[model samples]
Target: MQWLFGSDEDILKLVGRRGSFLSRIGVAVGIKDSDFPVFRELYYEFMEQFKSRYSVYTPRRVFASVDVRGILIDGSELKEYMLFLRDFVNDVVNTSGLYVNFVFASFGTSRISLPGKAKPVSVKTFIESTLKSYFAYIPVWTVIHRTGIKRARVYVDSFSTSPETPAWNELCNNNEVYVVSNGDKVNLLISAADLLLGYIGTIIKLRNKKPDISELKSYLKPFGFNDDRFRIYHVGNRDLGHIIYKDPTVKINPLLYRPFPIVYLIPELSPAGLLAGKDERKLIESSHVYEYILRYVEEQEGSLKIISFTEDFKHLSAGGVVVSLGEHSRRIAEYLRLLGFPLEHLNARELIHLYGGDPRL
Candidate 1:
């Protein structure tokens, strides 16, 4: 099956008692090609409804880009914004033939700086960097890896200047990537991406305020916005590079489970447990091991079962492979190592090569 991916960004500059800073939010959505007609119908209906309510004309292509910001101009318009988003999300979720997946990344601009340059980089450079680090490479690779699809098409709303870096070129070489202008006649998914970006940007702005947004948060839960699909790299004054919020109940490649179980021993304060606080970087580093193992098992058609380091050994089957993640589980790893299992610090790629196997598999 073919997948269409679209991306857009919302940049916000805020000034408060804590001082002024910038927040850049990039959102991407992936939809099946078979579902685009239904999505287009829903989008057109929403635009017509919006135009009737506000008495504002919404051109076919630029409806979301030009009109979504108008809904955020004041407090009174917030109600309409919430209602619009609520109805849109509800309708999309209830639709039978549509499958939409969303992924968003937020970068806090306060602690960002070039390594050697004294002066700051231009807005275009920042945009390119955000796209490279979070938007382009990871999102496309995640889709390809999860779906086992050979190729997917990506349509990014034009940033005026296209990225020319080697990473960007490599991405294009691997998949069909296009940077299309807002007025592009065939790029309907870009408008959906823009709408999502605007809604998420509003959530970031009001999250710290006294006004409660429980209802808004609730609306996004169905879209998996509060789950693994959402990632916050940096926010406010903190440079939190590794704090990823993912639901523990969600397993990687749920449908590809085999009877042979690979047990993963996690730290007591693992990111999956939502307790990675100040040790987020270390925890995230160790998470790569779990990710690698999970991917390997997925390719092997095996299953993975996660357990805390302090959990009992009752769940471990005889002669099963057990792997420990993070420094906190070092002792357990050592014990398992002595029992003839693989090392806890093993690299899956190197190990596969050592066994004269295909590393890609």
Candidate 2:
């Protein structure tokens, strides 16, 4: 059903393109632009032609990190990935006949506990700071290193963080970077960024267990992109030592990062149960201590109903009702969050305390 990728899972999948007709259209849509209809028709023809040429960069397998409490863009492994990603962008720019005028990116969600705070700060705020610091190394650094300047339009996908935040303002003031925080996935190219990010995230979760994570043929079929779309470099134990994309001339300097213990939230898994790793399993298990995770994976064989603690969290074990969760219990919270459910991350005791008592009690 035309799945779009703009979730916490797609944190690293920030899509950006510059010097294209699409970018031009995106930036210049006046309130009384009568040429929109003609432009829209041309855009439709462009999408059809794009699909026919197989020009979309869909990967058979996705690659992502294990979500550890360290730098978001630290270490060589991630560096290798980003450099390769930059190459991929270059490829797209060349193939699509688009100039690299600006790069579009939207920040995804993340959860991290702030010092002296009872809970984590806003997911988007923490991610914004993390990403701003991250770009100082790669893509942004690489662009300046290769092109000799840092002047580009950065269309930010709006999240909780406002464009007026100090970091964002500083970036604009220093770099003349035109900041558009309300970019949407209305165009084909931008949507590819979402797919690309989701693909990396999926692979990161699956790469640890399987030799090649592209085994998700059926899972990816619904999205109209399959394994054959792009090449996957399958190397065991992904580290900086392995030249994944392998560009000998691309020398990488040590990246600077601020260390913070970050807790990654998760979405429901693939149809074949192939998208989670040991770290994710641990995250699911640890939530047991907090009580968001009620039953273990084993306990949820064939239950019905997915829950968001907001509306569906009514305690029910009697009175003609039984509160039960589906097999994707770990993902229920995340799914609810995506659907715009405001769920305060709470432990079982905290929930009981908030609600006075578990109604099932």
Candidate 3:
């Protein structure tokens, strides 16, 4: 009876404010059936203590933003508040035997909304895409392969925008993945995931603001929050890419590829630099290449994997066809060529032309 609980942050609404640097993040925590009761008890106790101490009543769910906004907004209390959440999370993980995985995806709203178009593409579309890419596919794949669990009961916090994509259905059918609404009265794990994602988002913000995070680092070290136990994936943003590349321990296990071959789709840097850019033409072309490859892989019925790659060069050894798009393809091809890994390099426009699809479509 393995269980995986998932929730996401910065998703209900897109951060469209000029010059905002926040990212959408999702968390999935896996635990055994026997550990569920323990986790439930720990969560209840933590909630009780938190409510009593802060006078914030969280009867239904715990939102990191709603519950800890005061602490995060005040620069003076941010550190102390982080430590408090860290201690509680550590207690929960240590006591309940929880395994954590995170995915971070950043999008530039202005870039997504093309200037001349009558209506900009909805941010919800991108959010749904990220949810499908990060939340539904990778976590389930990793959990099944790592835990040796034949099937996992997955509970995801409800998102009005998340549609039942083919990937979701395929994963569910193939792996016995069950989607439970986080709103279910009996589900406390989703709330726990929410809290963890909030903490992670704060940590990212802190890292962006200042250089000194030694205190935070020390607190997270004991629990392996930044280590192998906690897997983290960056979907697109170059900024988050830098963070993932700097820490080798948080990488996706190459062994996950043992069950099936993977197609590593590397897109150009985002306007945010080094991943997909803000240019409408390049972005659209990249999306076309991504969709074409994704459909091609999905046609194999879950026998293949496709993931977005940032700067993590080590995964090149994972033994998969590497397809790089945009101007960055040349650089990636050269790097892989030097490493003796087989490479297929094509710009987004070329891939689109080869596939006989219109980029604007």
Best by TM-score: 1
Tens digits of per-residue lDDT for model 2, 1-361? 1111111112332233432111000111111124334433443454344334444322111112221102223553555344433433334322332322112233233454444457766545543553342232122222223334334333222233211223333333434332111122222223233334433444434333222235534443443332333222221122112111133233222111100111123333432376554544454444423232222111121111223234233422111112222245435544444655444332334433443444232
Q: In model 3, where do residues sit more than 4 Å from their true spots?
A: 11-23, 55-65, 68-76, 106-150, 161-163, 175-186, 209-228, 236-361
Q: What is the C-alpha RMSD of each candidate to the true structure, in Å?
A: 21.2, 19.7, 19.7
Query: Where's the lowest-lDDT run of ten residues in candidate 2?
Result: 22-31
Sorted by TM-score, highest first, which candidate order results? 1, 3, 2
* Candidate 1 lDDT, 93-150, residue by residue in tens: 2352333343333343523444344776653455445344334333443444445554
CA displacement after TM-score superposition, residue 275 of candidate 3 (Å): 48
TM-score of each: 0.47, 0.26, 0.47
Q: Which stretches of candidate 1 lie over 4 Å from their true place?
A: 13-21, 53-62, 71-76, 93-150, 183-186, 209-361
RMSD of 2: 19.7
Question: TM-score of the candidate numbered 3?
Answer: 0.47
CA error at residue 112 for candidate 3, angstroms: 9.1
Better of 1 and 2 by lDDT: 1
| Model 3 C-alpha lDDT per residue in residues 1-361, reported as the tens digit of each score | 6555544444322233343344455666777788887876787677567667767532322333444556344755677567766866677766677777665555545344322346645545545543443343434444454445555665554333232333344445555443332222224555566667667666656445321234434544653363545666454533322222222233333223222234455544653364434363355434435545543333322222233345345556645555555555557666776878654444445545555666553
TM-score attained by model 2: 0.26
Error of 2 at 242 (Å): 29
